[model samples]
Target: MAHQTPDLIVSRRYLRLDCLCLLLLMLSACSSSDQIEQQSRTVASASQTVLMALDAWAAGAAPTAYTVDTLQSIGKTLADTGAQIRSAETSEPTEQASLTKAVNDLSVAVTRAEAGLQADDRLKVQDAQQDLRLASRALATAYAKYFAPKP
Candidate 1:
């Protein structure tokens, strides 16, 4: 088993604490409607990529470093989406607040998945995968009405 050094413990705690504080940014009920729609779609698409990457790693189809890189790459997508959410104007403050929570939940799930890999804990990684699945569903269910239909 890998050693749980103090640095590892501290990093884990800090990452989790940061996760709890995650929040989404911008949304406007009127002019920014298109932007919100795009952001939600992006989140959904990026989510699938991350989940698939994690699954590949778990199934031994991918190496740890590759999986970690993929997770980090997708994690940046979440971060960008969150930033866009934070910066946009909102005609629906209540809806924005709800989206913020959903986005934050997804952000946390991503971090947890990466953490699990760092710790070399398959159980934790599995748990993170479940978290990602639930979080993704929550994000879609809570805000699907706002997205534009695909052609």
Candidate 2:
């Protein structure tokens, strides 16, 4: 067999190194994708919980207009959901910020409604309800935009 040139031996080593690097990069990308998917699923589940709580409150099932306990329960749910959104590990910082803001706003609105219930103020509770609904819609839009599949 002919002797291999020094340059050829170096080129072969470089090719192998490149192949190994490419495989490692591919594996890292897959891991990152899996992490993102898990984060999205967690956010989705929290969003669903908040939405269900909002629906119940809006349907008069919580007696927010009269009972303090129901108002507290709804407020707690909103706050918990907001906390979850804030703590979620999302790849997109801007989207995460917007979602956190929307969720926090809803939580604050619910707290205001709870205060209104405690004070027996119908107008205050109604206004807070409207704010909560608007916040919820904003959050839903953000969630859809962030989690939608790429084209």
Candidate 3:
């Protein structure tokens, strides 16, 4: 077999480098989209949990202490979700921006819910549930827009 020249070896190295870069780019894209999907689902689940807790509290089926605990737990989850939304490396900048807003809105609603629960104001708590539901819908809309199939 003939030995390869220096030029050939350099060319081979360049080809390998290009392949590695391409692989890394593809992985980065996949990771960004996956992170967005996961964060959206987590926020939706948290919203539903908090909304159910609010309903139970309104009906007097849930004690104030337990309802407060539930709100706190959901608040923590929303905080984490907000962080994920801010840091996610989305392929689409618009999608990223929309997600950030949605999470922020939801976080605010959670804070209001917690406050209302502590003050024993059922009206405020009910209003918070509506706010949270809307925020959750906004998140779902953004997520769907990002991942919707092309016609």
Residue range 41-137, candidate 3, lDDT tens digits: 8988888898889889889899999999988888898898889878887668887888889988998998999999999888998899899999989
How much is 70 displaced in model 2, in angstroms? 2.3
Compared with the true structure, what per-residue lDDT tens digits does model 2 show for residues 1-151? 3899999999999999999999987777566545544544554454455445545765677655435565566556656656665665546677777777876787677677667767767788778778877876787777677667757
The residue ranges of model 2 lying beyond 4 angstroms of the native Cα positions read 1-66
What's the candidate order when arranged by decreasing TM-score?
Answer: 3, 1, 2
Candidate 1 vs 3: which has more TM-score: 3
The positional error of residue 73 in candidate 2, measured at the CA in angstroms, is 2.1
Q: Give the runs in model 3 whose Cα sits over 4 Å from its true position.
A: 1-5
- Quote the RMSD, in angstroms, for model 2: 5.4
Q: Write the per-residue lDDT of candidate 1 for residues 38-138, one digit (tens) a residue.
A: 88789888888889989999899999999898889988989989788767786665666666677788888888999999999999999989988998888
Per model, how many backbone clashes are there? 12, 0, 0
Descending-lDDT candidate ranking? 3, 1, 2
Candidate with maximal lDDT: 3
Q: Positional deviation of 70 in candidate 1, in angstroms?
A: 0.9
